[model samples]
Target: MGYESYQQLGVDVADGVATLTLRSGQKFNAVTWQMHHELGLIFDDLTRDPDVRVIVLTGAGDAFCAGADLNWLRNQLQDPPTPREAREAGRAIVLGILDCPKPVIARVNGDAIGLGASLALLSDIVIAVDTCKFADPHVRIGLVAGDGGALIWPLLIGYARAKEYLLTGNAVPAADAVRMGLVNHAVPAGELDATVQRYARQLADGATMAIQFTKTSTNIPLRQAVESVLEASLAYESMTLRSQDAQEGVASFLERRKPNFVGR
Candidate 1:
């Protein structure tokens, strides 16, 4: 599988490890439509590549991912995708990660926000820097935590904890994230790379079939969870994207002001 076709993601494979970097550092590696579309496709390609035994997902510059490109999202208000299109797009990315047989490690070098947090939480192993924070501020922007948040968060922490953070749009510090079981390890900034590489190398050089099959076995329940809830969440998200409060949320965020959300 040739990854040269992708525009927003940088793909490099060497010594049984494939590193996929979100390349839009200028925007804090936010998820542009192109990035989102490519992400939904790249995992499948990596899954089939013969030399790729493990995958490391990270960002180019500072933040792991700041979530959706708000400007692009704002534009989508006038030209929103149909509910079916939205559902399928969201499903592709979610299932792509869940169904991939390879072990995926999230090297969260910086803050993981919104969809960014979802990406890290979905990985097989998540390692972050102690200075970084994890947040899924979907509701802050008047959006449903539909992408993978509603499915994964409660399973990682608990229903009460998930709701407290998701509803309030609060940021979870790295130390708390580790304590809450949101991530595997939170090391100092200098240790982030080494920790991720060590884990990736171990998984890469170990018995590949056992690691892959174990991941597959564990993901069975996740796939079942996806089937039960992901679509409804996505559909609700699609509807919310067209809501009056969402418009205010985006506008306020871009303008750097408080949003006066009028429930609609």
Candidate 2:
């Protein structure tokens, strides 16, 4: 399939391992709604590819992904959103990653924020560099932690710790994230790429059916827990797309000024 958008994310299968690289240079790999939709399609394709045994997700530049595109956010605010569209888009993206049969690993090359953090947490294993940081600043932007944050963080780090991080929108350093059970391992910056490659190759060389089945089985409970919350949150988040606060949030971000959200 051909993609017109500037962002380039694709599958490269070799030796039973498929590497998916998010190629949006230096702007921290910010994602657009089209990119999210493309990701869903890519995941669907991967599900049918029997040759692929392991999947690795990483970014091209120094940072992994900073999150949603500011321009996309602005357009979303301007157009608002229908309930059906919201639910479909939100569920498709989250479930695509959650339901992938093969083990998925996140190679956190650098900072991962908002939806980026969600991607990292959803993976079967996450390898982060010492300089890498993770955060969900949804609340800071006057929005609920509506994406996978609400659904996955609690499961990964328990209710209390998840609440602390989500509520505060604080940045969690690599070492601190590992200690809090948010990431699988933390390695040196120079070793991050090799570390991820080693793990992905190992899984690729292992029993295909066994690995895929094990991943699916382990993720069943998580998928169940997220189903309802994801449905509800997507509706609420869509409703906000029409609100003045969301508009102000986007404008403030682009203008580099504090938002004057009046809770419209």
Candidate 3:
């Protein structure tokens, strides 16, 4: 598809690899609700394309993503998200990435916060730049880590470490992330693209069925775990959207100040 065809993402295919670039530019590539919808559609389209052997996902410009867009959050605050929308969007994102038949590689070029971190963790292999940082700050916003964070982080780095990072919302450096087994590799910023491409090419040249089947087999536990907690966490996240703390969280973020959450 041409660049004009996408509003929030850019898609390009070459050498049996399909690259999905988050197109929000340097404003940290924050995802709007529309972008989430488009992402689901992108994956759906990719699933049907036979020539595509590997998928590489990265953000356009500097940062990978900064989580939800501030403008989108403001709108969502004014009109609280319905449970139906929450459940559907959440399921679409997690399932779309997890169930992809092709091997997905996350090329974390820079900081990946919130949903961005979750996306990286969900990928079959994650290669992050040395300068990259990962964090999930859902608790800081008085919300649960509904979208993949709660489900994937523990599987990657163990429950104790995952809980510490999630609760504290502290950033994890790329080297430390690799050491903790949160990422497959951490290379210099300049080598990030080449490294991901190299890996992608290797996968593309390998036995397609073997790679696909192995990926499917490995993801069974994750798929089951996500299914078990998805509904409850999504519902809880939506309920929090209606709370005073959620409103405060958005307002504080917009105002560039600490939130005075009343915990209603």
Model 1 TM-score is 0.98
- Model 2 accuracy (lDDT, Cα): 0.83
Per-residue lDDT of 23-47 in model 3, one digit per residue for the tens?
7653889988878788767776777
Local distance difference test, per candidate?
Answer: 0.92, 0.83, 0.87
Q: Model 1 off-target regions past 4 Å? A: none
| Model 3 error, position 13 (Å) | 0.5
How much is 100 displaced in model 2, in angstroms? 1.0
Candidate with more favorable, higher TM-score: 1 or 3: 1
Model 1 Cα lDDT, one tens digit per residue, 149-194: 9999999999999999989989999999999998999999888889
- Please name the candidate that would achieve the greatest TM-score relative to the true structure: 1
Error of 1 at 238 (Å): 0.4
User: After superposing candidate 2, which stretches have Cα over 4 Å from the reference?
Assistant: 1-7
Candidate 1 accuracy as lDDT = 0.92
Query: Which residue ranges in model 3 land beyond 4 Å of their true spot?
Result: 1-4
Q: Which ten residues in a row have the lowest lDDT in candidate 3?
A: 1-10
The C-alpha RMSD of each candidate to the native structure, in angstroms, is: 0.8, 2.0, 1.4
